[model samples]
Target: MRLFPQSLRWRLSAVIAVVSVLVAVALSLLVRTEFSRMQLADARRVQDERIQLVVRDYGLSGDATLGAELDSTSIPAELRAAVKGGKRATYLERDATGAWIWAAAETNGKVLSLKTSYADRDRALDRLDEVLTIGSAGVLVLGSLLGIVLGSRLSRRLRKAASAARKVAEGDQETRVGATIGTRPRDETTELAQAVDAMAAALRARLIAEQRVTADIAHELRTPVTGLVTAAELLPPSRPAELVRDRVGVLRRLVEDILEVARLDTAAERADPVELELGEFVRRVASMNPDAEVRVTGEQQARTDPRRLERVLTNLLINAERHGAPPVEVEVDGLTVRVRDHGPGFPDELLREGPSRFRTASSDRGGGHGLGLTIASAQARVLDADLRLANAPDGGALVTLELPDRP
Candidate 1:
């Protein structure tokens, strides 16, 4: 067990408990000091009155023997000087026997002294200290206990809200933190939970509206784009005709990507897995492109949706050709495909935030619409596969695809 816990719950509880104990102990000490001071003040007042009476008697009778009433050794030198000058003096001091007293007097040649032992007052203070010690300990224990319990409860609610936030970030747009947070004495944390839920709901609605717009736009463009492609095909073979055909092809691919993304957004893809030799299958796809070098380490058999998987490889290879240098390396190792190219590696943003449709890397890639890798990622999701992009250590870009043994 950790002497100091690293968890937020324990840290907060410790802070509350420490503050509670310190404040209670400080207040208790202040009360005891004031109580003792008031008791001592009362004793000194009574002693002063008796000393005045003694001095008055000496002034009227003029008796020199009245000085003998007080012990000479107990009389402090500073008090004696004050009394000799006809000024009344009072002091609280411990004598040779280590006993406390309130001494008061006035003198005009013969000292009019009065002394009272504070042994009873000292005993009272000792008893008061014992009682205060017990009371302060109880307050510290009780206050600290209450602080820890409350801290634990509050921390748990905060944790629930944090977990829900993580799920939302990971693409579960429907995630929401419960308003109640399963705690007692409704507090600020419950309000925070409600706020988190509201934010998530708003985000889900906005995303849905965005996907609907994308799907509608892609659907609307299909007929006109098809007609344009047909008109360009009928034209005589020339530079202008080729340009129109290429531009139309880019637009057609972009539209298809948008439509696919809209479908994936609505969770509409279904997997139809068929057993195949993954290594041979990867070689067959790589052979379609003459520039790429396919290296088959060993055959890895798996059950996966071939059509979706083919789309993933097609998009990835096209991206490699457009952005990366020639002699592209494709390695198939037991259900894993590592595609590396000699070029400036992927942009930092592309690695951190996964592929965004129509967002290009910092490096130039001809004039790509940037939908190739985005579509590949979406298709990989449909196949329940992992698609990762990274910058290889040896001055190149790397894309790794890993498929499960069974879909």
Candidate 2:
């Protein structure tokens, strides 16, 4: 469907090839023109020399039979007219005998004409043309090859830099493009690599500072939250007391979620791999939520950290149940667990950017801190699983978790 290649390497090669072809064609035309002119001039010179010889012989010996055609019609009408007017002239003509150059001039009231074969010059010109054509083709091919090599090298460097940038965006702070580029010369690609490295370093530092602040705040709130919980429990039973206790519980959970995120950010969670009957494990997790409908397509096994997977699935179920419309479904097929909710699907921003902590769904969709899916995704990563979030065709949020079946 594409008229031109999308790849930069091919685009560069094409550009160079087209330019080379144009240059070759232009040079060929110029060379051909010059060569033709030179050959014509040489032929005319030979014709003139023969004409001079015949005319001199006729003038000295009074005989025009020195291999000269007197008033010959072999000479063109224009050439004959010119000689009759006492003017010397030379002309080229081609016939069955190949090519000829004729020279004529007035000699004692007789037109003395001489002719010579121009086939040798024509053949030489043909050879020159053949050589030019071959050379032009060679230039085109060589230019294309050189363009491919240069473009490939440049594209490879750009890919490395882009990959490093992607890793950085995915929270791999240690990834650096400069390391991949090695000791290359400082060109545009090298500058881009350097820029990416600097950006990663800055982001890494800022993320560390943010994580430390979050962890410290959570740690500081833990003791006070515990005290609040105890105080709420001791209060006399009433509506206000219940509300206080509920809010205190919410606070405690928020602190826990923040701590968990901090730990995940630090990459401190290690998976304890265990072989699990994936269907049964999913059934058990889904059973905790009576509203969820669990279906197992077939028996399957996975080597993963069950605890982390449990956390991920629980979060997904809670998110769906709270935000989505009724009929939250959990389907286990192979090593994949799919959770779907007939809600307004995920918010457009959420689908575009994934989950961000504390960024809750829009008021129209549902209400909660957005940490559920974020924590779920982080835990899924710890289990080395693929967690994808998408909107179901019929309308709802669909979250798929695919676990590794092998160690």
Candidate 3:
């Protein structure tokens, strides 16, 4: 038979109960056996004492007439026969000359025979065995019942936890297994519940973030798409050159935005890193946009992918020109670069979102996708830099790019 139970709660309870029962049964059997042995010994001692008394009384009377005084009712017939039998007890009659003699003694004209007390002892032992058997049965029943009750309670608690976990798995973020104040769960179960709750919370947050990113992407893509459609419809060979240039510039900027987004996604795996000077680099990028006042503030150098870094700075300056009032300031510290635009700063809601693909704070702006800042932030990550967006207390948005001082 299998010794261990299958279920955890039953297994534990069975082990405890079985061990308890075995100890109790063993002790009971030992006590019962000892009692039975003592009883048998007492019976034998009484038999011996009576035999000696009867013999002494018969000898003093000079006759076998002491039989009438012997209480035969006190001893069973089997015991009397065994004590009187030649193999066990010797009976003798002596003449005046002390010569040995034998005489047949009868009780009421019946011959006495040797008796054995083994049968009585056997009966006593059988009674003891019966009592022990009944006690063991009771103990076993009681132990099993206790095991069942304890196991049932534990199983119920586990089932409740499992049910709550299932609800969480099925997308119920609020599902929780309430801590049992009456009987606290063990460490393993408590840890499992905690881990499940954490996972549910994380999953919910990720889903929400993804949904926001999707919405922002759609909003950003709409402006460029509408402009492209309008420009295509109004294409005219007779249009003024300035008008044509303006329309073409709009189309080129839109394409650049699209390409920059794609590059940010692939840069980490595709781009190669190179060494460059921060001071000269910022000056060169700023020169590209003369309309903006870009200044290098610190003398730190870095080893980075030049092409990607240039793209990042260029996009930032472009974003400033499109959204800010005037004189966009670019300052470089040891490993940090700060770009401040003199414009109405970032929207309060957009600051919490950090940055994501195609997300911009210019939904209210005339007609432009909010992709420039998003693209810049993604490129910063590919270069292993941190980009933070905050509003200047005075009045403007400050974009900080903190890079590592690389060799």
Candidate 4:
């Protein structure tokens, strides 16, 4: 059995219902007990008055005993014993017919009993029961409804904060929750939302400052890097000169990757969506990378930024060739593209932590600025696509890209 509701609204309503039930039961018992006590006191008073009347009658008639008049009354056994002993006694009890009987006897052998069927009292009790039953039902309905409304109101605020946090985590550093979830009444959840908004704002400022610094450094180094390349080309043909050129090229590529990452971080690259045959475009990208054997299957056409798609595919192919074995499979079915390589698959950190700039999936197997997959991922987001990395069960690395809104 499902013991609790996953939704907060139902849980709150359940709590209200339990409390209402307990309170209603307690109230009903207290009212019934008090009413019974009052009724019993009234019944005993009736019997006392009757006993007095019997004593008066016997004294006025000058009779020696009042047994004849007492025999017709419903005096209790205890009260009769007291009368025989020349003393007064009283008793209250219920009889076999469910009626309450109260009796009193006097010293002069006079006795009287009062029988109350408890009809009026019982009828009042029944009416009270009816009122309690109806009132309890009404309380339950209203309490649960109020709880649901309150829970929903609370849930909405939490959801708004949670949604904005997710957007921030997904690289939209500009997202903030404070505007929507204001700190009214200053509750704990409201305080938490304010904290989240502050954190997002701080992170956004830090990232913007970092990206600007990187872009500026890249721009500054371009002149020196170009000079080094010219000087290396002018050197005489030799092993050391070739090494100089090779190292310079690597430095140049690193600078370019850094600049590209900075641009992607700042949303500097805008997408130009165009209608293209996705299968053919991927096939062409595969042709550019001869290191991996590319196989294309299934045709699909979509409207998307072709240049960004090309960049994502090229990085995926390069990564597969550098870190994985041969036989890369590129398949496009509908709007989904799959790129698989025969290799040890993606590292655990890459799978769990996602792609990070300057953090290669495998340091020993490949060499780069470690921005290849990071760039691919950023471009995918820019194109409003999804790029996922995983290992094939058959022992290979798999990269899948999903595009939407087909033409």
Candidate 5:
């Protein structure tokens, strides 16, 4: 009763098959009806011709021998009855006196009998019907099988694309849809897979950028803040209030550095570079820490943001004093500054972390948030300088800042 199947391929095949069957059935019926009519007409013509021939033969004998010739022939008994009963085989005879007579006789006993030769035509029609039925059934079965094969291949490709997409959604950026060589997908599923890969790539880049920014911000804020807190808690009550003012000044500088780093991270503020004497700048910074001897050995003039660049150098100097053994050495090599201190070198682990926030060596003596190196690194980046930290072979931490030489 239900002719169509659920699968698309099967349903299409079924529809084609059903149509073929109906067409075959209709043609067979039409052919059978026409054949039957033609056969019946032929039988009638043959029966009429035989009856006429027999009657002519009987008349030529000049005798009214009705049942005599009928009994002597091989004509069936039923056909003989039809001839005698006058349903068929009626003959008209005319005499020389212009009188006409119609006579009917039975060659045998039955009525309306047809010869058995027509049975062959019936058998032929039955065979034709059988062939049509079998051919149509075979075609339907073959078509259905082909449809299933094609549908399964398409489904497999779709499943592969779906699996790849799910892996990407779960943060696996390396996953890719497996495509056969030179076989491009031409459907919506392929497009979806492409879009998913793009999204994963974008997310990976953004996450890395955010991490770098966070590390830079934290490292920049740590040093000055630690100094300010220490100075505040240790200031003597009997000393002139001017000493307290100096401690407050340190705190203000720390707050300014934090604000500046925040603005730089957001791209809300940009650095403005100007030409300045590099030697005078380093010498002025060294004057700030009178207790420590700061050696400057560079004479290169450079164009850079004076305030920001100065802050970068100041951070490096303070870090050296806090962590290094003694006497910080600042040497200028071409357009680069190398700050070396006689101290225990950085650990291997710190070197691998690159520019990270709150990175402190376990051997460090001071108690403060580890943001000095991170902030200095960020400032160097903003100024388009390369800052590298490594351990000197003999024994010391080496910090290098390379800037572009002014024309």
Candidate 6:
């Protein structure tokens, strides 16, 4: 289905080969033209000299002999016409016999003509053509080979830069393309690599500044939020007092979520792996939440950080419960767990751009601070698990968590 190669290296090589072939053909034509002109000129010179010698011999002996023809009709028409006009002319002509270099001249009342075989010149041109064909082919092959080498080198450098960009996109801010450094001239590939590294450095600095600000704000608010919660606790056991306490509690939880997100963003928390039965773990975690429906399909065990895993699952459950309709289902199969809620599925933006902090799923679903899935994703990273968020085919938000098999 493809007419040409999809690789940069092959395209480059093809371009080079085409150009080389054109150049080779142009040069070959020029060389053949010049050589033919020179050979023809030489043949004319030899023919003129021989004609003069024949004329002299005829004048001295008064006899037409010795490779000379008297008014020969074998002479070319153009050359014969020139001789008839009382002038000498030389012409190259080819016939069944072979190529000939003809010279004719008028003397007194008679026309003298002489011709020599041009097979030598023809043979020389043939050899030259052969050489040119071989040389042009060699040029084409050499150009393609050189193009492939250069293209491969450039392709490799670009791939390195692309790989580094992928890593940076995947939340590895430290990943960089390590471009070549030397006195040699920097090419486009090197420039691209350098640009990737620069972009990553800038991004890392920006993210660090954002995380530091978030962490600082959370740290500053923790004390005031704690004091507010304590004051609300002392107020009284009335509706207004309970409302105050509830608001303070929400504030406290928000602050804690912010702090946790900050820590996860900076990768300050490391996983502590512990061998545990995955099915039992899912049942226990789901049991804590009365609304969730747990179904352990198979008994599977894994070596993973149970604490981090619990955090991720808890966020998913809570997010589903709060933002989705009732009948939240949790299924454990092998090393994977699936959590689904019967409600309008995740928002298009959330599914497209992954989870973002402070960006609620939707107004339709009871919205919160919107850090649940973000925290869950970060915790999944720490646990070295794969967390996928999707809208179930039937309906509702579906989240699949697959733990790494390191048993």
In candidate 3, what residue range of length 10 has the lowest lDDT sum? 97-106
Model 4 lDDT per residue over 238-272, tens place: 99999999999988888888888888998767788
Ranking by TM-score: 6, 2, 4, 1, 3, 5
Q: Candidate 3 at residue 245, lDDT? A: 58
Worst lDDT run of 10 residues, candidate 5, spans 92-101
Q: Which ten residues in a row have the lowest lDDT in candidate 4?
A: 64-73
lDDT ranking from best candidate downward = 2, 6, 1, 4, 3, 5
- Which stretches in model 5 have alpha-carbon errors above 4 Å? 1-257, 291-298
Total residue pair clashes for candidate 4: 0
Candidate 2 least-lDDT 10 residues: 62-71
Question: How do the residues 1-407 of candidate 5 rate in per-residue lDDT, one tens digit apiece?
Answer: 77655655556555656666677667767877887677656655655655555555555763333333434354444445556654565222234433221223443352322222345555666787787678767766765666566556566666677777677654455677644211465666566666656776787678658756754664665666667667776766656656775767666665565555555555334568898877677778766655445455657778888787788888878777788767677776556777877778666776787645445665763544456777788778778788899988887788898886531
User: On residues 1-407, what C-alpha lDDT tens digit does candidate 1 reach at each position?
Assistant: 67898876778767777877787778878987998898788877877766777767766876523233643665777767766656776777776765544445656455556666788888888898888788877876776677678777777778878887887766765566774365455678877777778878888889999999999999999889988888889989999999999999878877888888888888678889999988888889988879889988877788899999999998888888889887789999889999888877788888899898878767554556667888899889889899999988977789999998767
Between candidates 5 and 6, name the one with more favorable TM-score.
6
Candidate 3 per-residue C-alpha lDDT over 1-407 given as tens digits, one digit per residue, 9 for 90 to 100: 88756786787578767876897789887988798668656655554454455454555763333243333453334444644433223233223534221222234333332223355555667787888888887887788778778787777767877888787664455567654312364656677667766777887778666655654664577677677656765766555755765776776666666655654443333446776788788888988767667566678768788887888899888877787767788888767888888888787776886655545565532234677777777777778788899989998888898886542
RMSD of each: 4.1, 2.5, 16.7, 3.2, 18.6, 1.8
Q: Which is better, 2 or 6, measured by lDDT?
A: 2
TM-score of each: 0.82, 0.90, 0.43, 0.88, 0.42, 0.95
Residue-level error in angstroms, candidate 1, position 62: 12
Reference-based lDDT, residue 28, model 5:
66
Candidate 1 backbone overlaps, count: 0
Cα lDDT, all candidates: 0.79, 0.89, 0.65, 0.78, 0.63, 0.87
- The candidate 6 region of ten consecutive residues with least summed lDDT is 176-185
Which parts of model 4 have CA positions greater than 4 angstroms off?
A: 62-90, 109-111, 173-175, 181-189, 363-368
